[model samples]
Target: MEQAAKELFETVEEYFQTREFKQFFHFVDAAIYLAQQIADVAKEIHLLLNKAVAYYQLGDSEVAVKTIRKLQPFERHMTASQRIRYLNTVAAIYHTLDDTAHYYEYLMQAYALATDMNEEIALLFLEGNLGHYYYEMKEYAKSFMHMERCLMYCERLNFEAHEPYIIGRVQYINTSLELGKMAIAEAQFERLEQFPHILTNHHYVLAKGHYYCICGDKQRAYELLAQVIRHDGQHETILSTLYERFLHVAEEVETLEQYVETLETYYHYLGRLKEAQAKKQIDQMKIYLNTELLEEMLWHDPLTKVKNRRYLDEKMPIWLDEQHSFVGLLLFDADHFKQINDCFGHRVGDEVICLMAERARQFFSSESAVVIRYGGDEFVVFYSVKQLEGIEVMLAQFHAHMQQCAFTVKGEVHHVSISIGATVVRANVPIEVLLEEADRALYQSKQQGRNRYTQFQQHA
Candidate 1:
């Protein structure tokens, strides 16, 4: 029976590799039927998991979730490794469903189990997955941390010949560039030179393009990036990333013609990508709406319509755990907020808070920064800072923008100012300590002057 099951699984795997998804499903169904007939619990669980993966790949996440839930009763029968695989499968389904919170949740669970078992390959895979997740989130520091771990593990396990090790190297190069770690990126690029075939690999090409672009060789960067687009333009995520890189270099280059041409190409690709994604999301939404598992509004702040304290509370620990090299936290307190409420009424105060939230949102890139309405008249902004100068420039821009904002209540002109306390989080610091330090800085800022900003000083 085991031999028969193995043969059937091989056929399913072959169909999957051939991109014959329907045939893959047919084989999986047959395997499940055989397992049921033979009353092989282990075989049945395996086939069911495969079926769930198929559903996830087909973008039927609702069905995938139901299929995975069917394995709950067999949880006690699963080995630790099998349980880890099960958790990862569920995480992948959540990722397909666009449920980032749950995706991270399950991935972390699997990571913990893998760590406890001291499973080198499992740890490497989880680290790589987490690195990609943070990379997509534009949390470059955290992304770099995980990708660095992947490289370390690859070397320790002598997995340099493996495909994932190559991919991990590519990702590390890309993320190191993002974090402005040019030396690290260049070292990784040289390492890739050992693998001649990686020169033509799309990810390697893209990373090299970014490295060159950062090193002030826009022409070479453009050539490599153009090659990537020509070969892998259909991949929306890759195209989007290339488009963003184009936008970044557009400002630094003296010539506009080539940049404009690349922008046009990127715009065309992005339009097609967005259209396809929109349709897919619509279909996903229909499935979600039909099911009883409606998403909750727990993460959003009602008044400002931004992320709430709960969201920040949930995410901050993950960022800290990843040990980002430079995490910047800014605590903003509306200056004289009580006076505004007393003078204009609570409704007007609410309007001011909303406007302030909107301006805060404008000051930071949505992909990299998180703005939370921490409490009444206080907002917290947390973002990964690639350089100290970047944080300074952002602070200056934020201060200037606040000065420009003017509000009118009952035809009376009013100007508002915010006291900001900023701090760079260091490695191994507890989140509570980080917050306390920022709060102390905020108090100092208020004491010095309500309208100014203060950087946290450990001695002061």
Candidate 2:
């Protein structure tokens, strides 16, 4: 019966993973029915929660809210993780309903729970949502603060191209532009350009168009905005803003024909925007659902869930091919990791390794830095910096973070450290030679004393 339950749960998980929302709803229904038959309170709650989330995602907010409210009696029975999920789902429902006060209330509750549970991913999602909320409220400074926090988590989790990070980056840029922070917006634009997928994304294109509009490039802005209208005409809020911008630009057109054409396009977008708003009101009564899943194998490390070695191998060549110079590489290994495994068992050792990876992630939480779990207890970080001083500061942070990490085994606390080697790579240098230099420096650090970093000195 346990095996059957396990298989059933796996099937449900696969349905969710594959983004088969309808199938996921059906599976959850079946699971709930079976769980009720077996009188398994925990399993029943779990399935019901899944059902509520699925309903929420399907645009059945009323049903979802009602379903979740039924779980109030069982709230005390939920695990910490399950409770966090429940709170987050409630926050999402409020957000959908445009109930800003309730959204913030539930989100903050979820944030506190996530922090207490050390659930990094959940905290990141909450931060991103908060950022979006503040951005929409026209509180630029507050939005930037939350978006920056989201960006840090995105970097730490190696989720550079993920939806949350992408959205956060766009929001950050938009707010910066609104605040007349042209330099900051330009810098963010460069980073946004690094992801080719952004060019095709409706929100990204709209943000880029706004940036151009702010920078006094009316023609370019109009072209980009047109692309956005073409692709995302159904997005009422975005189209409403785009329509206003179009009208503003149309008034500034030099030629009569240009003015007339722009005005016609503006009217078209306005019509679409109104139609979309009406459809949205109708959708509130009907069900809407779709799913888009990311392929995790390309970038993720299976064990530590950081960027894998393959991500490093694939990404580095692109930079090298582009002749990106002054790139810094840091290769590090856990100090006395084998000794820990021998003394504390492999389970504890694995935990220590994961801890080290997490520390590396925190240390390298910058857009330019790419942290990879090279293999086993060793990790590699590649970062782009014009000056060696920047690399030194990062290395210092890495050392400090390592010193601060604490691991507990059977009520006994243990400290772990890493030995790191660093080297700066030039465009002309072979990738192998760059890696070897970093590896040599790492060996020197270990030989001198672990928990320190050594820089590879280039021979003239």
Candidate 3:
């Protein structure tokens, strides 16, 4: 009888040490079954928790829930701190299930228990979890405060090793900024930027952009907004709001008011005229993204694109209008190009135009240049020249460069040249009128001599 008892103890010890549950047959085998008959429910509960964690990692949330439920009888046997921890794990499972109500309730219970037991780490995680729930519910004030405390706890506890906890600081800063709590938001936002891993994170950059927006620095806001747009141009709801807000604030500055007016005027001409239209576009964009009305809006130009127009409208306003000085626009015209369509096939003519457009793009100095087909054979080179006198000289160099390239059609080489109308923009000039003036100058170049560059005149 003693030998049989000794054999049972050795088998149970091996079962616990080996995680024999990895095999269904072993877990359900005669050995564990015999041990289960002998041992209390608490030891079973402990083993079940470990199994549940493994199942949760495998995306088997249902099974994890079942395991947790099966362990409920063991809760009475656990100590105070262990019970709190057990509840927190259950809360986390609810999170994976997206049962937000259960998640919050269990988290709150764990937080209460942890507070009662004086377990600081458990309370910190619980407070942060509850704050996330509140933030999702749009209860900004309390959410912001609790999250602020979570950030402080992470800081005080030296939790730099955990990235998500640090990111909670940025998340709260964004929530506060949205709520218009600028003073506290600014401090939180600055801390958020200093979070050691800000460079690569979307949330970090967005927090910084919102900081600039909230601080009423429209120039920096636009700049950062441009960066965000470049990195992820598809998130139009965010990009549109940032652009509109930047434009709104820029309009308020007396120094920028003239150029800002021009910027809106250009957008109006581009069919984004009214505040109602802008708002409608945003709403449509939201619906298109949400309801599959459009799957890939970013790739198609808002106006005309086999390519996206967002790339143009987001950046060119500031580039051509000169929020910063020393940028140039070279308006290019297809030489007697309209006559070609009237004489030759429009298909042949379109092929020629596309070839000419490709040639013009090859002359760019940086990623700063945007070549919009602007409608037909008329194209615009909206670019910034980093070096002085570089903007004007670029056209001459482009013309010289174009003189050498040949296009092949049906294996036949075709030569094409374009008239260039260039303009330098100052912050004082409105971008719409400036571009219009450049187009007029472009016409003058075509009349006097095709394949030549002309600078636009400033109206008094």
Candidate 4:
């Protein structure tokens, strides 16, 4: 079989050199078969490039990426700019892998290589990726910078068929919203409907719905939101948009009690909680943040900057409003914080707290999760594991990143481990109730060992 396959590869190579390639009516089957048999990735790449060029002329990038991979590289065959475009595609796959930091690293490399190669097209993709990454990371300045860069370059490249316009539009809306420019966000979102090739166009609708609802256009808000949900039949992205809109709505409107009611009704009618988790977390966080506008500040832990008892009290009220979300809280404390302070002094102790908090913060890289200071030496982390599942995978990758961050104190290097208690907040409970629930989980962590996670159970 090996000898037969080798003979086949040799025949295919000879066929590729024939005049058939020069003919307008090239035999695709012969060319394709020859391309597939190339041994070296580089030669494979040449074969793939021929196919890619063909696929591209056919206007099928999705197929191009897939077919291109089956072929190997051709040394110096493609321009440097072309190679950078290939790298950009590789970076995109990493982005889809859902590790923000790794995604950022690969994208940055692509951008640098593209710039060095003078590939404007590749740079445009890099800029667009950076826009979404920074937005997800909650770094507004970076997001805005990259988004504008993407738009400018895309226009220069005349990428009307690409997603440049739409990605820019969505990035603009998110950047404006984060910066508290609701009006700008609305306008940006309005532009998104007309923008071409946006993967997240439905999100624009939800953003408008949530913005109007929060701005007191209750009728328009509810109607828009309903439209958003209705569009779910046509688009799957609707679920994430609905979940985001619901969270923002929970913070702004009172009738979201009805919003929750409607969603709950649908969930039962549909019989699935898989999509409802994000809505649940948003509802609970809203309750905690809105707990008596004035007293809401009381529950937060100052040192760790997590929700304190006061925060928990406020959050408790809306915990079960959605019949599902009630996000789990990881309440963590540093064991023997006093020992570190006593050995290194108060200054060192403060530094340790900051360091630990910083690491805990990394757990929320995508900004979908909330990490807060519950009180002195106590921190709370609430993860909305809906739009993003696979928490364990995230944690595993996080471990690798953490190894690179060395915390130094008092002319010495000291690493601190935290005890985390994780538990789901029962539905309809207040933030305070959730905290208590999480606290019990925290105790279990301490009992089992100081430096780990323990889940709160039913009735625990």
* lDDT, residue 260, candidate 3: 67
- lDDT, candidate 3, 176-291, per-residue tens: 77788778777865665665656546666667766775676757866665565455533333435445554554565436767666476446534533554577546433522343
- For lDDT, the strongest prediction is 1
| Candidate 1 lDDT by residue in tens digits, 184-255 | 888888888898688767677768877786788987886666666677676665646665765676556636
The deviation in Å at residue 295 for candidate 2 is 37
Candidate 2 global TM-score: 0.55
* Model 3: CA > 4 A from native: 1-47, 57-59, 209-460
Could you tell me every candidate's TM-score relative to the true structure?
0.52, 0.55, 0.40, 0.42
Q: Which candidate ranks first by TM-score, i.e. highest?
A: 2
lDDT of 4 at 452: 66
Clashing pairs in 2: none
Give stretches of model 1 more than 4 Å off: 1-6, 13-20, 57-63, 134-145, 156-158, 178-180, 231-238, 247-264, 270-460
Ranking by lDDT: 1, 2, 3, 4
Summarize candidate 4's per-residue lDDT along 424-444 as a digit string, tens digits.
644455666667877987788
Candidate 1 yields a Cα-based lDDT of: 0.78
